[model samples]
Target: MKLLLTSAGVKNASIRTTLVDLLGKRIEECTALCVPTAAYAMSGGPGAAWRQISGRASTPMSDLGWKSLGVLELTALPSLDADLWVPLVQETDALLVGGGDALYLAHWMRESGLADLFPSLRDTVYLGVSGGSMAMAPQVGEEFVGWKPPAGGDAGLGVVDFAMFPHLDHPDLPENSMADAEQWAAALSVPGYALDDQTALTVVDGAVDVISEGNWRLFTP
Candidate 1:
């Protein structure tokens, strides 16, 4: 599967250009899934969150001539049926995960058995933004918002071996954000990428490439 991991939502025009260039040909053919809010939040009520996510992509996706599935429903653990969701995953040419609480999403992924299901979705192109990107990493560091870290070796889906630190250069963001990412990379003895809003890390068949309008850095532990 090809993984498109972005640090944030599509903000700059250039990044959007890169995205279009990368997927425009197949956009109209893919069944896009937007996991907007974390599953925990959805357990309460996910209507608002779903609307926010779908709305962001509706215009741009339409402009790109992409046929969005408009599947804005939440998948809870008790209600999760692989037969149901897996078909949605398999039928879709691509899956788009939106930004939110990484830990919350990770928790649900594990609970819904999606962590195991993902590897089998090898034919599906996985696109992630912010929390979405972080959810695919082996580790997401300690400062994640809204959820607690897992015990033992339960980091994330481990779809990729490296850790990801998104929103690397937001002006009002904390100074320690990047530092913590660097430190986490060192502590784990693995490679890490720090992405600005417009930057993205693309992984296909285990090959890693960077796509961005500005500079980014790679950290190896």
Candidate 2:
């Protein structure tokens, strides 16, 4: 699987270039599925999902004009047959997942049977924004935990080995300052990254690279 994990969606030229490289095609040629399940657990969540699906959010996702775009609401997957949705996911060029509650997204991804399919999607791009990206980590850190899963803890899907701290130094989220990221990382058992809106981490074939047009930092524990 190819992962383009960003703090924000395609917010800058550098991140877009990395996305194109992962897709191996223009944005217009790819077919993407927008996963908005996580947003439902967020504040003003329905509105958040609508903005993401309608491409009206600050992020440049659904508005990128893919060949075709669809929504993959994870919450509703449990009631449907796998045959009904598995093929769609397998055929899509990318999964454009937006931000919200990390554990909530992780719970549904696991419960929806999507996380189980990750190993086979070698050619699929997983584009994650904020919570979307954090949900793939082994742990999101206690500070970011919101919608606690039944199993409990800040654990994620472990899709990637490291944890992530997004929106670093974001003016609107003063709590996400560098010092805050440091504190967050100090509690984790693995390495972690703090990325700004203009940065992203691309993972392909187990290799990871940072693609950024803004500041970022790596903290190792």
lDDT of 1 by residue, 1-221 (tens): 67878876555676565565555455666566666645335333355355435554422221334476644244463486557676676667666676666766777677766666677877666667777788888777665545665553437667788878777757767763667667656766457788887788778789988888865778887
- Could you give me the TM-score of model 2 versus the true structure? 0.99
Residue 206's lDDT within candidate 1 is: 91
For model 2, residues 1-221, the per-residue Cα lDDT tens digits are: 89999999999888888889899999999999999988999889999999999999897788888999999999999999999999999999999999999999999999999999999999999999999999999999999988988988899999999999999999999999999999999999999999999899999988999999999999999
Clashes of each: 0, 0
Error of 2 at 27 (Å): 1.0
Report each candidate's C-alpha RMSD, comma-separated, in the order given. 3.7, 0.6
User: What overall lDDT goes with each candidate model?
Assistant: 0.65, 0.94
- Alpha-carbon deviation at 217 in model 1, angstroms: 0.8
Show the lowest summed lDDT stretch of 10 residues, model 1. Answer: 56-65
